[model samples]
Target: MNMASDHAHDRPHEPPSSGRRRFCQACIGGAAAITVGTVVYPIVAFLKLPVRLGESKPVQIPLDRLIPGQAYYADFHGQQVVVVMSESGPRVFNASCTHLGCNVVWDTAHSNFHCPCHGAVFSGEGQVVSGPVSAPLLEIPFEVKEGNLIIS
Candidate 1:
């Protein structure tokens, strides 16, 4: 019998070095992150309210805080919507620009909505005033009641 070989075989294996242990831990963490990102991101986005509506549900936005002659940006069904109070009344408009689907910001000085992309300009009522866009932003359906905006 080979006593030396037998004794060596019976000994417990030595632990991995610190560098190897760190590498293994990092690999495990990376794999876990990848799995979560691939699985969780889509699920969370789907569960939240979508920007677009298929079956319209009414969302009440309190208007007590809104000031006349000012514009308000709000989330409608997890999508961005803009509201402005004009001489006629409060109106809701899509926050996305007509050109390239870029977002528009309210220009108080101009009394219009300006798209940072392509320099497209729209009226506070969502009408296209100038720039590349030929069409105006689509108006979202909303009704005012008891100092609140009921949007669908």
Candidate 2:
């Protein structure tokens, strides 16, 4: 060992194919990844990002206009939602059928949700009362805020 210099003379040198080459390859890969991410991020922000159509906040629906014993339809965040005014206040249900993606309508005469495509039926509270639909209708998260119904 030289007193004026720092060196690893006592240790054996690692082969270039096993140690040096691998270190170099790892450094190159890391640099390439960083460069790609930096270049792609601006393009993603400018071109790949979707346009802003509306606010990200929940949609507000006027529950006061709903009439009891009737169902009201509303578009919430590009999805169809139905609210039935039962005797117990407001009951919200997803207007989509459980068996298929068919749109369901309220059967005023039968007091149930009817899917015309496959003949699926559900109660006002989103419970399936008939076959072909093993599960109930999907329920969305909602709240009544200041006489208005908010769906998220």
Candidate 3:
């Protein structure tokens, strides 16, 4: 009774609307862009050199402020340094332990530098005293300039 109409209904459906297709394409493109950005940003950041904002200035401390048998800590070029005033004169040393790079603490009572991490001890003159380290504490060079201890 209605063969033509039945054949029309049996035909394959039309493709999705262009607006929906465009929306799906945009979503896929957005996801791909996000993935690429996430992977690329860290690599770019790692490869780029960091900016050195300021010059490394010399560290200075007044000789009058230093007391014998007491320790003075200072930051030099982003590294920790220590000054110990003994009866002989002023001595400066890198506070980090040569064993594992641990910061050494000044023991006023014991009159030496102690590494808490490995129990390494260093004399006030930066000589190795005891413990697991073979190398002595690194001595930093300095000069007495106008009564101020200057470490460059």
**Number of the top-ranking candidate, with TM-score as the measure:** 3
RMSD of each: 10.6, 9.3, 7.3
lDDT of each: 0.84, 0.84, 0.92
Cα error, residue 148 of model 2, in Å, equals: 0.8
What is the C-alpha lDDT profile of model 3 across 14-67, one tens digit per residue?
567768677998999999999999999999999998877664889999999999
lDDT of 1 by residue, 2-112 (tens): 998898789676577768778999999999999999999999988997666443556677877677778988766667888888888888888988788888999998889
TM-scores of all predicted structures:
0.60, 0.62, 0.68
Error (Å) of candidate 3 at residue 122 is: 1.0
**Ranking under TM-score, best-scoring first?**
3, 2, 1
RMSD over all Cα atoms, model 1? 10.6
Comparison by TM-score, 2 against 3, better one: 3
Per-residue lDDT of 18-83 in model 2, one digit per residue for the tens? 977798999999999999999999988888757777745676778779888788887776678898
Give lDDT: candidate 1, residue 19.
80
What overall lDDT, based on C-alpha atoms, would model 1 receive against the true structure? 0.84
Model 2, position 119, has a per-residue lDDT of 90
Single out the weakest 10-residue window by summed lDDT for candidate 3: 11-20
